[model samples]
Target: MTLRSGAVTALLTATLIASTAATAASTPAAPRGEGAGVLRVSTSTPLTTAARLQAAGFDLVESRIGTDLLVVGDAAVRSRLGRMGYRVTVQQTAPTTERPVSTGRTNGIAAAAATFYGGYLTADEYVQHLSDVAAAHPDLAVTRDVGDSWRKTQGLATGNDLVAICLTKLQPGDCQLTPTSTKPRFLLIGAVHARELSATELSNRFVDLLANGYGTDAEVTSLLDSTEVWVVPVGNPDGREIVEQGTTSPYLQRKNANNSLGACAVPPTSSNQHGVDLNRNFTWKWGGTGTSTNPCDQTFRGSSAGSEPETVALSQLMTTLYPDQRGPLATDAAPLTTPGYMLTLHSYANMHVIPWGDTTTKAPNDAGLRSAAFRASYYNGYQTGQPGQILYTVTGSTDDYLYGERGVAASTMEVGPNSGSCTGFTPAYSCQDGFWTANKPAMMYLAKAARAPYQLSLGPTTTSVTAPTTTVTAGTTFTLTATGNDNAYGTSGVGKPTAQTVNAGRYFVDTAPWNGGTAVAMTANDGSWNSTSEVAKATVPTAGLTAGKHQLWVQTRDSSGNWGPATSAFVTVG
Candidate 1:
């Protein structure tokens, strides 16, 4: 989302023209120029201006709902907006030179993934990484070919097969498409816009964390044992390939590589590109606000709802993974026992975008959704709200579709800061580590919450769990301490969650409570669990345990009868 800054403007003269023609049969006239730049147009009615510019085939960089519109185009764009009687300023011009590519491997899971632009993985590399993970961790990971990308559907060799990886400790009914599976499912999709390079990297790291940290990391091991984590790292492979081919200045392609609709300019610029904005092509609330009928525009909703193959493939994958827990009404809330959570990762906004993205209306399960968002933000410190409240409105987005049609607790994570070295769609590779460090906890929290998102989100969280000694001899006793906080939710966003008293706390050995593990009561440090935060301690005996590591899971309950997600610490019997 970061653009190179420049000084450019034009005098007011011509009137604004609204163009609608966007097919192969007819082409609407537009302002022509040499290079693209980000233009900020001051308008009294920003939303109306955004709609007009989108309809006229302008790529919107960002819209400050009430202040101004950030449009991306060339000098002609600046002139056109200026002549339309609105004061326009150039924020940044597109970079002219290509970024240096890197071949250094930063992590072990996907060594081949580092052979792309500054360590970012290509679409093919991402799919190969999934295969590598599945091969390396056969017991815990499996790769599935979900569907074909748009190009592949068109019988083009340049297309890619949509691939996803499921990570969990395999059991009899695990990783199946049936909605009645025993384990809760968490789905993470990245790079839906194709140009958001960091999204795919974060997805890869999450996979690596779960697949590699299974035996050593207690928290990850417990999650893998009890929950199913699915990741589609390259959601728009065709568009990502187009982005990968940008050796001379990264091609800012925001959509899939489908070029049959409109006569978009050849050698796509930052602003003028041909393809459907896959985010706007979903079935729910399609062709609504913040979308364009113009095929060349960035937010183009295709010829029909779910017209693009990529959109259809993703929607189908969701349907296969989750059951419809909600009734067929916008006001019908998903039951508290809903067992799925979904997150679509984007870049540069640094916000947790919740459902009802097409409008300002609150979702049916607004409290639950807000609580979950606040919990995630507690780790990443990102702003949380509906799309219209933080970024501009977006229709037919992945979160809205999943939450609306499938009744899954879903949201979109806009990664990266608004202004920094790590900002924008194409950030420096070094920024990946820092971003991963900041977001890993949030990702883990969301994945764990997938088990009972609505109910668990309202309960007190196990902030920390620890064992006094890492290694213990067989037939010995050890002390385990855990801290629970009913106020762990983030307070930087709308709808502050009310904190309840920590009524009770308990621990289980080597098993999750949902799987019928026997719970052991823990005594609070202050002699009672009557406060918002409490430290509970338990004496665990290892008399019959074998000489190996065991997971000590801890959970806390609120006064409202809600048991929070479990956290774990490792204890090894020597």
Candidate 2:
């Protein structure tokens, strides 16, 4: 969703505001005395300092955090936050959640192409190839460094800055916060593993194909015109160079050029070369299983979390590109676990792995992850499961980190053109089209995942905290009471929903048994507007939908759009 510039900052944006504006006049006015005793206080004070005013001793019934409070029953707390520099309003707090669902988006894109031919360029050519592609499509493409990399790219991309490429047809002028963006930011990264050469080639080819299709192909042209496309062709540029220089034969180099692990580096560079595997260097499931410590071994987690410059650089980019969980720039204060679809390109095994990279156990939301993973992978001609479980467990993977830390849902796809040696990143050009035909759909799948606007979630307070995620049974009715709170519009003065929505009597799952089916989507309404959710499926397990920790959510709708009110929980499976 769009952020509010100038004096105010909105994360959920007015994406859902339109809904509230249209529906406020329609909500049957609350019963005379029902919830009438609740105190209402508004303030412009900072949220953290405003909490003290919400306690019962203070007689604070409902404390609204924002630019100015609309007072309901109490004027004391309002005045308190006000004396403390908060703008309080003594008005009735809305009985229900606001129709302010933010346009939650994923950093992925649909890479469906007409031919679906080819993978990425050579390891050495990965970056250059992307650069070349961007150059070729100057209108739709532009290159920028989101951040920096480690020593490998430090010299090349300027402190390892991400040499990112972006393509968009909408400008800030054309499509703005008014009607809300009909589009979202979609990301597709290739070569998280320096040696996964196919990813780089495939990503490059996808970009070129889209650029070429801008006017020629209908589907390609449509996607390009709709979403903002960003691609990181060579995630590990330095490693790629090493793989390329290692004799005429391309050796697999999964790590970055970080020599932190003294032994991780060795001479013959190609054969069993050393360095922290970039894949294993992320913050998620760090120092977990499926990782090695032989310095020379692959899948080695770095000395500590974020030890690599590459990892650090990417983290910085996330902070800058994405909203910050800290600082004056916080993008998503609530649990952003409602993930957009993501596809990370790897090599060899044709497996689509989901989250919980820390253990052999399935992720909390195994059902949702399983379904989306399978679907995305299926698009690309692959299978989906836990990376280690399906293929082998791994630690410090980028996908895990993105999902675990950033509230993003992502998957790793090991694209193999042929079954043999040619399958690695260096597959013969002859097999490119076959690889394209198989994986192009996966790219589309990710894009589709990203496009979904809303997500069912638990409390906005417990952000990224592990909860149950699984498939529900078909034709079965069940009450899932997992939810969180979010204030779509947050301001620096005295706004922002610091806490996730608490389980309310009328809105809780027990109060409202949501429709449980294969195609159950969700969104949020922050009382002012609403937004739609990503296309999340609530498939029921055949035997029955097992009980486990699950994300709680409410499906909301209004004139403007849909929003989310998801809950998080783990339960017993049947």
Per lDDT, the best of the predicted structures is 1
lDDT of 2: 0.46
Worst 10 residues of 2 by lDDT: 488-497
lDDT of 2 by residue, 1-574 (tens): 1111212113212322442334334542321111121223443342323233322112221112233322222222334445665443324331221122222222322122111113223343344445666677766777766555675454633224457777766455322212133455456788767756677777887777777767644335445555666677777766664444322234345677666566533321221346776776777667666555656544556688778877776655443333322122222222333434456777654656677655556554454455455444434545555643433355677766665555555677767732343543455556667777878755754553454422322212111212234444443544432223233221221111232233221122212233332224432223322221112223223243344332233333222222332222332343
Q: After aligning candidate 1 to the native by TM-score, how far in Å is the CA of 81 from where it should be?
A: 3.3
RMSD after CA superposition, every candidate: 7.2, 27.0
- Model 2: CA > 4 A from native: 1-125, 152-161, 173-182, 263-271, 323-339, 453-574
TM per candidate comes to 0.88, 0.53
lDDT for each residue of candidate 1 in 229-347, tens digit (9 for 90 to 100) = 99999999888877765544456788998999999855566556789999999999898888888887788899999999999989999989998999999999998888889998998
* True lDDT of residue 87, candidate 1: 87
